[model samples]
Target chain A: MTPLIEANRVSRTLADPEPFTLVCDASLSVAPGEMVAIVGPSGCGKSSLLYLLGLLDRPTSGSISIDGRVTEDLGEAERTHIRLERIGYVFQFHFLLPELTALANVALPMRRLARLTGDQIAERAAALLEKVGLGDGAGKRPERMSGGERQRVAIARALANDPAILLSDEPTGNLDSANTRMVIAEFQRLAHEEGRGVVCVTHDATVAAAADRRIHMLDGRIVAGD
Target chain B: MKGLMVLLDVAAAHLLMRVRQTVVAVAGVGVGVGFFLAVSGMMIGSQNDFIKTLIDSAPHIVASDEQRSAARQPALDAFPQAAVTVRGVRPQDEVRGLKDWPALLADARAIPGAVAAPTLVGAVAVRFAGRTEAVSLNGIDPRIEGKLAKIEESLIGGRLIDLEARPDGIIVTRPMADRLGAHVGDTLVVSSSAGTLQRMRIVALVDPDARAGFYAGDIAGYGLLRTAQVLFARPNVVNQIHVRLPNPQTAERDAARLEARWGYKWVSWEERSRDILNLLVVRDVIMYAVISAILVVASFGIYTAVSNSVADKRRDIAILRAMGFTERDVQVIFLAEGLAVGLIGVLVGFGLGTLLLEALSHAPLTMGGKPLVLPLDRGLRQYAVAGGASLVAALIAAWLPARKAASVDPVEILRGAA
Candidate 1:
């Protein structure tokens, strides 16, 4: 089967007064049901490479493909639609909208896609929250929840659309070790048990140890584990 | 529909987070709309009031014989295609009267929607007690004049029927009666410019001060048609024909048709008050300009609020975009916030305006020594205009900030925070 996500010789460079290269000639791919962790020092372009693969940022001179469909030339609207339907992203911080309840935050992506009715959306959001260990925090706002609970709610929100590939950028940077452990376990189950492709950028050894494979980056290039 | 609901929900959540700022923006627009309504209502209402006074107090149309230098000569009448100039054209100094006025009056009465009457109007000097005053005397058939002008309604002491009972009878304005120290049964001598004198008994007195007050130059007295004709030394002739149409708005058109058919000078009330009517139009333009300025100033407040909202919610915008919301959706959410504020303000403003108008309408007023009421035009058109204008102002003010919010780059913001 084709890789769930493929980036062929991708490079992202910043156009600025003092120019800088974020990712250079980095080609990588992840097959279905694989959990891959990108490990690197700070300013080693790990998050930058992940952003390009997740279709959140444009590469300067290379292309990306998700589920064997190339996405380099798609318009902003098409890219957004693909992001809504094909990919999910979790950030370092929970980043849940402070005004919405935990359930509503999980349902935001589903509502934007509008493929489900209001009741179906709500029901699916509730199930997702329960799956992430946030069943009791459904009606509570993010401000009222603990940091670990909020991060779990964010994970539930990312999975609301049942995307094929899950991407994370420093997913546990703001969490305690206990919360980080819970998040790492969730990523493992999402890839191994649910048979979804998972890619996470992390500095923690425990998170990298749980992954099926690890890619190391240095100076904007994939140094190993191609 | 479902997509719109989500947008609205997001907009409501955002606004609810900034309750105090939202209230301030809403109140700003509300005050703007209220002031607009009050000022515009008063201006339009007073315009209507003045127009009503003009239409009610005078004949809707007056058709009179044109003043000309001389009758056409045989040469001027018979010569075909001739531009003949006659030297030394002299005006005939004769008493101005319409020839065959009774037949013309009958023809005028035949017109539809017109109340027609022949009036022999002349200037007379009245001597009573020790005072002599120059007064305008209107000679009319009491029955026809009563229908055209509400002569009976102005009667203070005696009825208009008294003039019919006594042919040597007159009705004088109360100010004139007071100046002459005359009563209902007193006799006064009235002499025309031609030195023709008649002693007429005052049968009634009308107080013009009751409604539209009489001006100092408006000394008015009335008599029977025959009495005026004898006093002016003219028989079977009237100088003026007055017609009151069913609708004063259509008087100008009817007067134009009458002048075309009768070969006379016809003047409608609209033409008579053109100068004041033009001033009213100018007043309206100035009123709208001032009101719009106030609204623009009020919109600035909304602008600041929306701008700050965009700044405060930049992170949220980036998050929404990452969640797959289109830029258009983000823009619409902010625009909806502005529209909600405007709609709420308009509703509150209209209520306040209604109360203000009610207060104004009941307040006592006077103009020209007569009691008057403030004309408050409570029409729906003005309210709609005010509401629509305020909504537009709010939308315009919100547009820039909404665009700013939509253009926020998720990568730039997300990477910065990370």
Candidate 2:
């Protein structure tokens, strides 16, 4: 099957004050129904590579394609449009807006996409929360929920727009072992059962072992498991 | 537009998170707008009332027996451009009065909505009950002067027409009447500058508080034109013509036209009161400048509130960007927050201002020993101006902080979190 997200020799450099290379000649592809883990030690550019693939930051010298569409030459607005319609993001800290409840947080992306009625958005958000084992916590705010519950709510939010590609940056870095296991299982089900592409940048050994494929990086370059 | 609703929701949520700051900012704008309305209403209302009183108590145009320009020297008139200058040229002695006043009066009365009256003014002294007082005496025809002046309205004791019935009757101000210890039907000897003396009965007493018809001086007296003509030793002669028009705003133009036609000096009320009118303009500029300064100070409160909000929500902004929100979306959220505060503040201000004006209207004010209520202009234009200025200030204040929020890089924040 064609890859949902592909990076061709991608590299990111920061030139302010001095030149610094973050990701260099790092190439990878995430196919539908595949769970890929990019693992490395600190400052090895695992998250940087994931950012380039997610379209959050443009690659310095390589092309990025989402489901066969070249995104490097696209304008900022077009890149943002693709991110909204075709990709979802999950962060390490949950990052749920403190003012909103879990259901509202899940409905946020859907509301921005604006493809469904308000009623439909609410119903789908509730279902996504149920799928992530947060059915009873839809009305709870992030501050009121446990770490595990918050991470699960974050997962439900990532599925809001029904995007084909999911990119998570250290999603389980702040969760306990049990929560980490739960989040890993959720990712597995999303990739295997729901047929979605899942890419996680993580240091957790358990997450790397559970993923269908592991891409390892060292010193800003992918050294093995491409 | 549907997406805008979501951004508004996010903006509202952020404001709710810091409720105290939002309320304080809104209150600042509210106070600014309220005071603006009340102060502007009072100042403008009094100005309009004073102007109306001025127009009503005085003639719109006064055509006096004087020349606009100095009479040309006969030698200069004979030589269009003479090399030799005539120094210290003496003016010709002539009687001071309109040459054909009856015909001029007829033409003046023919103008649209004009009420013209002729008067002869002279200085006189009245003696009664061992008291003698100097008075500026106005000789008027009761029938025409009634329509031109408010003499009938100002009378305290008897009717103005009584002067016409009693050919030797006169009217005196209350102050003059009291000083002379004179009463109605009392006889007093009046002497004019021409050394002519006549005995006249006191027919009416004018209220001192009534400003119309009476000169604003120590003592004023009025009598029939024939009585004054005979007393002043100038029979069948009028010295001044006073005219009131339907529209006082056109007085300047009408005065110019009348001056050109009648060959006499005509003065409009606006020209007579130019200094006072200029002072009013300066006062208005100062009032608006002070009010605008207050609003600008109030807008700083909004700036501080929104700036703090942007700082507190930087992380949330990054996460929203990662979720595909554009920089423009972030800008809209903050702008909406500022506008919401301004809109709510304007509504509260309107209520507060109306209540304040209502309370001030019944204040205990006295003028000339008579109870007076404060005049307040409750026009809609003041509200629109105050609200518009406040909203514009608020939007500008919000724009600065919103621009900062929109430019935040999500990758930096997300990586820092990791």
Candidate 3:
């Protein structure tokens, strides 16, 4: 099976007077329909690696390929376009626009990608929201929604373009245990049933345990993988 | 640009959020524009009327002698050896001796820079048509008067006085014309300022000021200088010879030179209507001060409104930055709000100002000697200036706020908001 993303000898260094390396000598491949979770302690560069993998950040020294396109060599606009069309981000804070409703938030990725008609985009957004258990709350703004619901909406928003890969940074960090389990279960279903690869960075052992494979990061270096 | 479009949307939202403050700020500017139009219109109208009156009555500068005792004038100032004669002149006559009336006229006509200065004399009746009023009579040379004043232009319902033909004809103002129930060719008798009575026929009626106090159908402008002198028993000598200046204001230097050359006195129109012209200038100052006060208040309103919006929208701007909206976008959003306010203000101001001016024009308001007439076309420049000032004020007021929005920290805003 073709790998949707590959990172070769990637290293990201934080430039400052102290100059600590966020990710040092790391390499990884994410295959189609794979569910991978990165487990880490505080300051372990798990989120930074996720950012680099999602093309939202560039590695200091490495080659990153997304579906065979070299992201490191791409211009800023082209990198952003790749992020818009093929990479969906789910952050712990959701970052949904307060002025927009759940439906608009979920439709955002499609809106930027320009690959779907308005009606098709709306239909897909509705189905995604339905899959995330927000069947009738499309018109509600993020501020009006519960934290769990907003995170769910963010998850739905991430799948907006039906990208081959999903990247999440602390996706279940702000949710209650029940909501976290449900969200983890949804990610499992998306990987297994929908056949889309997803990479998640998490501090919670339960979320890491739920993934089909796990990688533990310590001090900006990957220590073990399962 | 799409970014600009989004910026406008943001601006529109901003305007909607603080509707009352925005409306008040806009209204303040609108009033300023309106006030500009109204006041400037009145001033410009008055100015235009005054200038037109002066122009229509050409030879804007008229040099006239004040002495009225002499029976005749030298026909040619340049002709040092012209013959002069008079019927009742003594050998020791203090008056200059003259002979050959026809030859004197011919010699006078031939002088450089000196056109014909035909002369006239007549008296206004103290009482006419049962209405008693002290009125001064004037003697005039038709051809010479036409060059110096709008003698023919002001004649409303009658022909101008024909000095060549009737020679006994006179013109009157519309009010005086109406008072006597007189028209062209109507006979009217007038007594001089010195108690000399003479009868003359009305040939024309004219009004120098149309707003009030006079009419085109009423002051008597007599036809011929000869007939006037003959009727009033004054021969040859004339009070006030209207000399045309080549260049109007520059003539002051030349006038001083002429005064030195001929020992004659002079007065500029500014000197003639010193009080009113001074008043006009003071009124202009007061107008600027008043409009400035409104602008200062509006400027404060703009400052408060834009600053307040900046504070409220800081997070939104930061989020935009985080989402890759450039600093330029942030600046444009706030500035666009200010501009939108100014545009709406200008539109409202024009409506309000034009309405007020039209109302005043139609209303019966009189000032000093003229009725109010708003000249909108003349007021347009002032309107634009005031509107531009308001726009600049809004933009300047928005400056600090826009800078704040541009420099907002995305992480801090999210942290604080969360």
Candidate 4:
């Protein structure tokens, strides 16, 4: 099966005053309907590799391709377009804008993408909230919601544009065990039932174990993967 | 369009988050705009009013016996090509009045919409009830002077035709009449600079309420041209020709044309009052500069508010960027915030400024001893200018922080947050 996202020998370095590498020569690929977990200890560049794969940061010396389109040479605008249409992101903190309610947060990406009418966008945002078990909380702001509910709202927002690749960085890190299990199950359902490629950078053991495939990293390079 | 709407929505949300800061910024802009409108309106209104009064009170164009440029030296004229340096070459003794002025007067009257009058201005002394006062006397043709100036409008007693009815008739200003303890129909002894003494009857008294009458009342007296000619011992001679045109704005061009053709010193109303007009121009420059400074200071408030918002919302900005918002989108969001404040401020300013002008106009005031109301030009152009300046200032202030926000490193921010 064709991979939804692929990275070839990707490396990211910071060169202010001195050279410091974040991701070094990392190569990875995740096929459709596959759940991949990148596991590492603190300061191991797992998040950095995920950022490189998500096209949020360019590799220092390697190329990245998303769904057969080479993105390394693409400009910032083009990369943003690809990110808007083909990929979704979830962070450790839900990062939902505190000024907006749950439904508005979910509708934000669709508004930027502008692929649907206002009514359609609203309906889809409500449906996404319902899918994440937050239908009754659509009007609730991030500050008004619990950590689990906020995380669920974040998940609904990430799925707004119906992206094929879901990239998350410690999405359940701030949630309780029950909330963690709920997020893990949602990720599983997205990967197995919905045919989406799910890649997560996590320090949680249960999250890593639940993935269809686990890639282990040390320092800044991928050490072992299948 | 949908993208822009979403950006505006986010911008509005951000502004709402800090309501006090936003209101302060908007109020700053409103005050700046309000002051700009009020001050500009007063300045422009007073200028236009002063110019109108000037044009009404004086001749549109004046042609005098004097020459704008001194005549070439007789020696130089005699030997055009020779480098002749003549010392103490005295000019010929001639009368200091326009020779053959009747023909010039005819030519002046021939001009379209021109009402021409001839006058002989001289210094004199009026002795009445044993009180003597020096006065500048204007010897005028009453029939033509009435047409060329608003002399009739300035009369508080008697009539302009009274000057023509009585051979020794004179129109003295009300203040001068008071100083001399004289009234209409009173005969007073007048002595001319030429040492000629005569008895003149006061035919009229001019009101000092009029701008022209104020000066006339201070030191000037008007009489029949024939009576003045006899009193000054200079017959059939006039030194000045005043010409009133239908449109005073065309005075400068008409004065130039007449001067070129007649070879006399033709002074337009604008030329006569050039110093005052230039002062007005300088006042306008200073006024605008001060107003611009106020707006700049006001925009700083906007800059501070927006900068604080940008700083507080850096994390949200990164998340939005990560969610696929382009740098331009981020810029638009902040720019919209600044513009929204400016737009609302302008509306508030217009309302406030109108009320201010209304209040000012009703204030009891006096100008040149005449009851006056404040003149305010409430033209739409002033509103446009004030609004445009405020919006431009706001946009400029917002641009710096928007650029900073757009250049934010989302990956770094996300990493740090992680």
Residue A12 of candidate 4: its Cα lDDT? 91
Residue A42 shift from truth in candidate 4, angstroms: 1.4
lDDT of 2 at A163: 91
Fraction of native contacts under 8 Å reproduced by each candidate: 0.59, 0.82, 0.00, 0.86
True contacts kept of 1: 0.59
Local distance difference test values of all predictions, in order: 0.86, 0.89, 0.70, 0.90
Tell me the docking grade of candidate 1. medium
How do the residues A2-109 of candidate 2 rate in per-residue lDDT, one tens digit apiece?
899889999999998799999999888899999999999999999999889989999999888999999988998888888888888888899999999999999999
Candidate 1, residue B118: Cα displacement in angstroms equals: 1.8
Q: Residues A1-226, candidate 3, lDDT per residue (tens digit)?
A: 7688898889998687689898988888888888999987877888778878877568999889999877887876676567666777777887786767899778755654556777888899999999899989999988899999999998898787777788887888899999999989988888888888899999888888888899888999999998
Chain A TM-scores, candidates in order: 0.98, 0.98, 0.96, 0.98
Off by over 4 Å in 2: B70-95, B99-114, B127-134, B143-151, B178-186, B210-215, B232-239, B260-263, B365-370
Q: Which parts of model 1 are misplaced by more than 4 Å?
A: B67-95, B99-111, B212-217, B362-372
Q: For model 3, what is the C-alpha lDDT against the true structure?
A: 0.70
What is the C-alpha RMSD, rounded to one decimal, of candidate 2? 3.5
- For residues B232-306, write the lDDT of model 3, one tens digit per residue: 566775544444444445534544544453333444444455687788788778877887677767767777778
Flag the better candidate by DockQ, 1 or 2.
2
> TM-score of model 2, chain A?
0.98
Q: Name the candidate, 3 or 4, with the larger TM-score value.
A: 4
Cα miss at A81, model 4 (Å)?
Answer: 1.4
> Which lDDT tens digits does candidate 4 get at residues A1-226?
6689888898999998799998899998999999999998899999999988998999899888899889978999999998898899988899999999999999999999998999999999999999989989999999999999999999999999999999999988999999999999999999999999999999999999999999999999899996
